[model samples]
Target: MAGLLAAMTVSLTGTRVSAIALPWFVLTTTGSPAQTGVVAFAEMAPYVLVKALAGPLVDRVGPRRISWVGDVVSATAAGTVVLLHALDLLPLGALVTLVAVVGAARGPGDLAKEIMIPEAAERGRVPLERATGLMGVTERLAQTAGPAAGGAMVALLGPLAGLAISVTCFALGSMIVAWALPRGMGHSAPAQEAPEAGQKGQEAGQEGYWRRFGQGFTFLRGEPLLLSVVVMVGITNLLDAAFSQVLVFVWARESGHDAAVVGLNSSVAGATAVGGSLVAAAVAHRMRRRPVFFVAFLLAGPTRFLVLAVDAPVWAMVTVFAVGGFAAGFLNPILGAISYERVPRHLLGRVNALRDSLAWAGIPLGGLVGGAAVVAAGLTPVLLAGGAAYALTTSLTGLRPEWRQLDRPRRTGPSVVPAPRERAGTTDGGRAERSP
Candidate 1:
């Protein structure tokens, strides 16, 4: 368990470094915020589009293999960026294309890490929810340390050096996961045997990797509860993505704060994320996960932008950003636990990626649109509109009948069907077969 956590932290640190270096790379080269936005979009577009397709592949190949492959590819891509910049051969268009390639490879990598968590927990005998909470904490820690580490590394050693550090961490994360995680091919315990391999994965509600990817689309089409959750998150993601980077820079510069504070602003938010994650770690095991989730989703939406619109004093800005960042911490774990509780293991990978792909679809759009909006709308009004949109989306859609399921006790066991409320009606499998 400790090993898993450590591996995740290392992976998260690499993620942190990339966030800092990628933007700096574009900004330094182009001297244009719009171009930076393009870089962000280029990377995320592939990430979202490819992740939608990668989940079934992860499941088919097994997450262990997929994760290792993802790590190796990601490391090479990150390393490529470092080499290009170091050799002074970096071209703007080529750099964006390279980052996008990194983004494409990262789809499976990110999903592989996610898929590994619950499986690792099952193997290690730790509670599934707790393991996911640790993943959240790892992300919070990464955010807390990522920007500062990236900034310092880039400032002192250059962005190429920062990318190199990210590459090393990615490689290390992949290697550790491959070595440490147990195989789930029914060894010590059968636990549950899924569909037979090479059976086309389409029978019994399954499909081949490519076929299963298509099936995920069908599966999610009518599920309003899951769909709404995906939509609400997608909207917020777009909003946040648009404003997240620009807002801080605009806030610091507009307020005439020190050049040093420009970077520190993100750090403050990262710090607060650690606090929020600690809270998530504490309450993550509770049965009633919905109230906190509902509340966090509703609150975190506008609060992020309201603080931005006010353009508070630098200290005040930092405080609010910190609060918002902390609030955001609850999101990933809560959603992950729900996914674990709700989704069947057989289809975990494809569905996980598909759903996440939906939520992330707007991320690149946000990055691109925000950059253009800044020129036309100015940062303040754009921020104001983004905040309002966030609140409206959350309030409008979350109050639905399907969403009620999130509040109910989730179905459990190793089956796809709902758990019987009363013991009398229970059966051996998901179906209502007679107890002979």
Candidate 2:
């Protein structure tokens, strides 16, 4: 499990690099943050929408196959972008279309990876907390390594060329998944050779594609904790969406600097996040979850706003991002573990989809909202709003009864009276009893 995750981490580093490079490239090339934001929205919108739709597909096709397909698609898409750029015909519309495809593919890939953790571990080789911790660590490592690598790659080869490396990494990761997996009719469907009656009967037992798809919605509606968490998270995410894309380039423009300077800021955030991921891996299980969630949320908002509020030195902004990234690092694993532990495995896809969809639900609005925010009060006010929203949402949610207590083991069934033993099954000594 660790090996798979570690290998996959390399692929994610490619993704991380692209995240930095793509926005910087878009903003610089167009000289418009709004356009940069449009690229972000196009990518993220499909990601959010398709991820929700694709979750059940992961469960159905089984994680390994879905993962491979997603990776391959993403790799191909990335390579296409590179090709377009090399040809010098990479229009903004074309870029948006390509990124949207990548986002769509990534939805399945990410979902499959998340589902595989519990499945790969099976009964007891890996515990949820520990596995999730390691996942956090993997992500952190990517965060730390990705930006600098991306920056260096872009510097040496240019942004379009960087995609070639990313494509290679993703393809390699997919190959790793393709070859290594346990097989035997995964995804809980009837064998293809089943009799007609058996097939009909099975169809009744399991939902068709459309029916199964709708169940994702039903599942979310049935669960209160899931709904609450997603809603609050969605709120904060909306606030974040407003500034996440244009941060570095906007900052550089505001400070009268260059694109390279923007990369430096992104690299700092990635570095700090890596440290936080390691810490999360080490201490996640020992820590009570509620407090951790609350405190992290509380810290994230203010740190984000503060970074934008003051016209401090570059290092000062970097410091703020470091703090914010640290807080951000702890969130996903904690929430993922929560979902894993509490939600039933069969419904994991829909649940994940619902949560992810909600979290990303605010993304489309980012371009419009971010543009407005930048125009009205400058980056500082926008950052401040994001921060305040982050803190306020977390604090309020912490007061909920369900989230107040840390997660623990759950009872599986109602208690029943114990049946009397049959004369102790057999007497062994002076207190011997007759057998039936």
Q: lDDT value for candidate 1?
A: 0.67
Question: How big is the positional error of residue 430 in model 1, measured in Å on the Cα after superposition?
Answer: 30
**Least accurate 10 contiguous residues by lDDT in model 1:** 427-436
Flag clash pairs in model 1: 201-206, 201-207, 202-206, 202-207
Please provide, for model 1 over 352-415, each residue's C-alpha lDDT reduced to its tens digit, 9 standing for 90 to 100: 7878877776666775688788789887888888878877887776666666776564554543
- Which candidate tops TM-score? 1
In the range 1-436, model 2's lDDT, one tens digit per residue, is 7546855686787787787678877877889988987897787778768987886676566667777888899999989888888789899989999999988987778776776666555533776666776677676677667777787888887776666777887888787776655553135322221224455536533656666666656656655566677777766666665665554357568878787655666566666766766777678778887778668766655576666666677778777777867776667667767666655555566557666776666656755687777778777667667667667777777777656434653311112111212211000000000000
Q: Which residue window of length 10 is worst by lDDT in model 2?
A: 427-436
* lDDT scores in order: 0.67, 0.65
